[model samples]
Target: MLEYLTSLNDHNLPYPDTIHPIVVHFVIAMVLFGFIWDVLGYFTGKTQLFEVGWWNMFVATIAMFVAIIFGQFEAGLAQPYSVAKSVLNLHTLVGWSLSGIITAITAWRYVIRSRNPQKLPIYYLGAGLILTLIVGVQVYLGDKLVWVYGLHTVPVVEALKDGLLR
Candidate 1:
């Protein structure tokens, strides 16, 4: 599987496989979104998307872990564009940190949800707040990579240079 993953990381084009990094970006975004929405809903005395089906959030959180692994590899060593290695390293570190945060939050929430579903508002609120802040930081770091660190913007010359014809 490690070899398979390494081989798959090279096809950074826009094909099905090539688009995986983009999907990882989305997974990060969605996990943040879900966490934030749940937090806001809790404070406002409202019900959010994950408020009902905690199971789905668990599944998505797992998916986020997987996506982050793939994205980290691609961001570090995927072909062409040649993003700054340090910047992507920062991205990977931030991602792993978020995963840790999510795992801890998920565990705490699991205990809370199973104990008393109706009275879980307070516990959920705290978790949501922590998660929101973490995600917010992750988003900012991502933006920095894209704009300032050249992680997101690929030079056309590099793209063409990496093209098969070249």
Candidate 2:
């Protein structure tokens, strides 16, 4: 994914900025942390989390929308990168699916039961932790799709064309 994203450039002109990739990485990391929190709840016993109601789920789900915006924005600036087209499509599909599942699970307790998260029966935190790892894998896959494949001609290219690679 990094290879593909690194290959972004309309008219073969490399992007000359860095904000997009850094921000995208930051956001993805944050989202993963949220899932980690959920996973923590499943393991080591029913750990306590602030019953912030829908706010917790809301932010995580909304992050997906933000990621899509950044993704499309970067893609727009770096056209003709065929790898992005395919990865972007897959990314969007997986993101929406994950968000939907998260919402559904949260809603079951928040909306249907009309109860606070604290009142709901505890679930296995291992499931959530496993999911957190899975999310990381997805993000890594996106990176590989862009980088490993995009950098065939320029192996040292930074994934962030217009922004800081770090």
Candidate 3:
């Protein structure tokens, strides 16, 4: 049982890079584009774009949850130390928060779509814009974990194995 659980780590994955990032990019793009299309559709009075936005938000909502699950799993196996710990914690916090936020927004979007697919309310767009900003911050936190701290990098892994990080 322990071996099976251990084998679920990022290192044991078939790919060289982690799966979280791959899955996360989809969430990012979909959410961003979803909000964009909604905003554009609202201004342009384009029903077609609203349709696009609704589907995008729908898919993004599902993908964000998938990303969060993989993120939590990968984060558990990260074995972060020292400075990376704070970053990882923050990233995890925001990741979960964003998942909820996105889900809520998607629900709101769904209702708005069902009621009036022709356009979204200004306040909803405002909330989406705010969500976009939060997503930007989340991206920054993720970047710091990978680029600045090298959480799962080969050298960092070697360092951890050698007792260089604690």
Please report the candidate that would top lDDT against the real structure. 3
lDDT per residue as tens, model 2, 1-166 = 6776566543233454534455556545655555555545534345354243235555656665666666556555543245456765676576556666655655553552354454334452444455466566668756765566452123324444443332
Q: Per-residue lDDT tens digits of candidate 1, residues 1-166?
A: 5555444222343323534356556665666666665665565656544464365457557877777866765564443234445656766787887778777777776786778654456666666667777777767766665566543234532453467222
Displacement of residue 34 (Cα, Å) in model 3 is: 0.4
Worst 10 residues of 1 by lDDT: 7-16
| Residue-level lDDT for 149 in candidate 1 | 50
Model 2 residue 84 CA deviation in Å: 5.5
* lDDT of prediction 1: 0.59
Residues 15-79, model 3: lDDT tens digits: 46688999999999998999899888889888789888889989989998889888887787778
lDDT of 3 at 21: 95
Instruction: Report lDDT per candidate.
Output: 0.59, 0.52, 0.86
Task: Tell me how far the alpha carbon of residue 161 in candidate 1 is from the true structure, in angstroms, after superposition.
Answer: 5.8
lDDT of 3: 0.86
Instruction: Give the range of the ten consecutive residues with the poorest summed lDDT in model 3.
Output: 6-15
For every model in order, what is the number of clashing pairs? 0, 25, 0
